[model samples]
Target: MKTIVQTPDAPAPIGPYSQAVKSGSTLYVSGQIAIDPASGELINDSIENETRQVMKNLGAILSEAGMNFSHVVKCSIFVTDMNNFAKVNAVYGEFFTSNPPARETVEVSALPKFVNVEISCIAIS
Candidate 1:
């Protein structure tokens, strides 16, 4: 059966969606923005800071599902501008030491709250 995952450490979904969903040994996390859970506001203005917050948010969801960045098998990143790609990747790289998960980064017209970056992930236990 499918199981829903959530964590108070992560920002609550602004709409109708669970923080993550687990099926067997795999967990699928929803896209995470830079919104801080406690303050309910974006963490910072710079793409680097925002990307760090986004990674933190994803980490919370992964932790809640009994996983971590090492367990992540794939990631999908969305950015408002490709120019921020290197900065975002720098922050994202901090989480995975080696053999980082398969990933795709794409520039999009917009994102929730018009945030500069957003990321979602899938991990296996």
Candidate 2:
């Protein structure tokens, strides 16, 4: 069985989906953009800031699901511009100081809200 995981600390889903879902010991977090959960506004001021917001959003969902970054086993990062990969990775690195999860960063033509970055993760509790 799966349990829907959500938190007011994270952005609400824009479509018909939950922020994250937990099944057994694994939690699957949905892709998170730079939407500010408190204001419901996009935070695209800078690539670093944008990525930070995305990570925060992911963190909130994981926390709600009773997990943390250390529990994450995999992650996927999507960026509109490959040039911003370094910036995004720097902010992401701050979250996982050691034993970082396996991740793939992909550059795409565009992303939801046209934001430069989005991130999602899978965690094992």
Candidate 3:
């Protein structure tokens, strides 16, 4: 069976989608931006800060599904500018310390709320 996941700690879906979906032992997390759930404010002060917020949002969703960074198997990173890749990677690395999940980062033309970064992940519980 498939289950939808959600949490108040993470930003609510701006459109018609759940924060994540779980099927069997695998959970698919939706791409997360820098929207702060509590205040619904965009956190885009700097590349690092934006990345941090995006990670935080992703963390919240994982927590809701009773999972964490260590459980993540893969990640997809999206950014409007490749110039900020290093900055984003630094913050992203902090979350996954040992045997980090496989990931790929790509440059896109734009993102919702004009944020610089967004991240999605897949985790196995």
1-125: candidate 2 lDDT, tens digit per residue: 99999899999899999999889999999999999999999999999999999999999898888788999999999999998878898999999999999999998998988889989899999
Candidate 2 runs further than 4 Å off:
none
Q: Which regions of candidate 3 fall more than 4 Å away from where they truly are? A: none
Model 1, 3-121: lDDT tens per residue?
99999999999999999999999999999999999999998678888999999999999998888899999999999999988899999999988999999999999999889999999
Order of the predicted models by TM-score, top scorer first: 3, 2, 1
lDDT-best of 2 and 3: 3
Total colliding residue pairs, candidate 2: 0
Every candidate's lDDT = 0.94, 0.93, 0.95
What residue runs in model 1 are displaced by over 4 Å at the alpha carbon?
A: none
Which digits, one per residue and each the tens of the lDDT, describe model 3 over residues 1-125?
99999999999999999999999999999999999999999998889988999999999999999999999999999999998989999999999989999999999999988889999999998
